[model samples]
Target: MDLELKGKVAIVTGASQGIGKAAALRLAAEGARVVIAARGRELLDRVAQEIRAAGGSVAAVPADVSRAEDCARLVAEAVKAFGRLDILVNNAGTSATGAFESVTDELWQADFELKLFAAIRLARLALPHMNRQGGGRIVNITNIGAKQPRAKSMPTTVTRAAGLAFTKALSKEFAPQQILVNSICIGSVRAGQHEAKAAKAGVALEQYYANLAKDIPLGRVGRAEEVANAIAFLASGAASFITGSSINLDGGASAVL
Candidate 1:
């Protein structure tokens, strides 16, 4: 099916690896001119080169989204490179899981800065461009823990809850302008953190993933590409009517409806 994404311009944060990198590749494959952002210069450039090698139009911008100035610069560079921005995928974040008492003020502040505030700042910066262009899409990559928090999940859950609220609020405020805003609440997707855990456990990578699947109803962890597919759809014309909604990309692991 045609996503109607050809010639569209997209900016995907955390694009150096994992779900962000996967989403960037998918958008470019669907014919969007993609601007990939991450703090790691070499890895970000490598992703861009891979996209270009596949005959996709892409550029890599190294930026730490946790900084407000970096967020502004990233958006500016994308606009300068593409002339217009059609999609903003706010996928830059790290998991900050801990017990409530273990999560100090510093951890909470840092988590909010990177996950919640970064999305807020980027959306604020990009909304005018979308408004001027008549419409756009914003996809926030959150986690199911936002809706179904566990006992020990502290800073991450709190911040992701804020992200969920942000997505809904933006969707309502911008829908009249045809600017759709949505979020994908991911579960146990294969990412760098999971890979590192597997290595540290001295377990085979595949076995570690299999162990993770034991708790999931689907009996498997999600792939980065699978999450990317969801993000691409949300950013495409096919999802024109979808807004203010948070879809769980988990493998039925989340108990909440």
Candidate 2:
């Protein structure tokens, strides 16, 4: 049960809410010094407070990972606060799904910047620090759509597919140095976006979730904490040998896996 995370330092992006928030809390619970990042300053601060209330060491850095400078700044801020970086969770992204024709050039550019480029830049920045420490973990938060692409799921699926490839390539290049890389392929987890969509449709939240579960074999949508459990495990010392792999956290919803 010991994740062996005490005294480690981790940076989690898109960490203001949902899966990101859950991952931050889980890492802090395991006694890791956590740096939480998101575009929303208020929500980011709240998460930091919750971690502190739980007696966890944490720093909140509000950054839009889609921007190159922000990604660099996030890394610098974390190292400045903690003196070293041991884990990097590239979780800052939104699910932008739609018909190919309906997807604008602007949307494509934005998706690549947020989901793909950000991860690239952060890993590039975090690698040297990990090298100094001798080893580290980079847990990319991708999703099942990366492997099981469906109709009308253009940019999101495409972006995530790149993430899977990135995870493998990075892991292979860094394994000799003991810098393990992996990804958590998420499923239909209950998130802030789903809550907003349910409210907009005037459907009760539970009913909305019930409708979503109709197609899932597990008969329920996944919780953020469920995904966080895997994130924490992958980032911990216990997962020392795991690299260049993607764990599907879909509860039997993903057919390809």
lDDT of 1 by residue, 1-257 (tens): 89999999999999999999999999999999999999999999999999999999997899999999999999999999999999999999887898788988999999999999999999999999999999999999999999999999988998999999999999999999999999999999999988888898899999999998999999999999999999999999999899999999999999987
- lDDT for model 2 comes to 0.95
Deviation of model 2 at 241, angstroms: 1.2
lDDT of each: 0.95, 0.95
lDDT of 1: 0.95
Clashes of each: 0, 0
Residue 52 lDDT, candidate 2, scale 0-100: 100
79-129, model 2: which lDDT tens digit per residue? 999999999999988879999999999999999999999999999999999
Candidate 1 ranges with C-alpha deviation above 4 Å: none
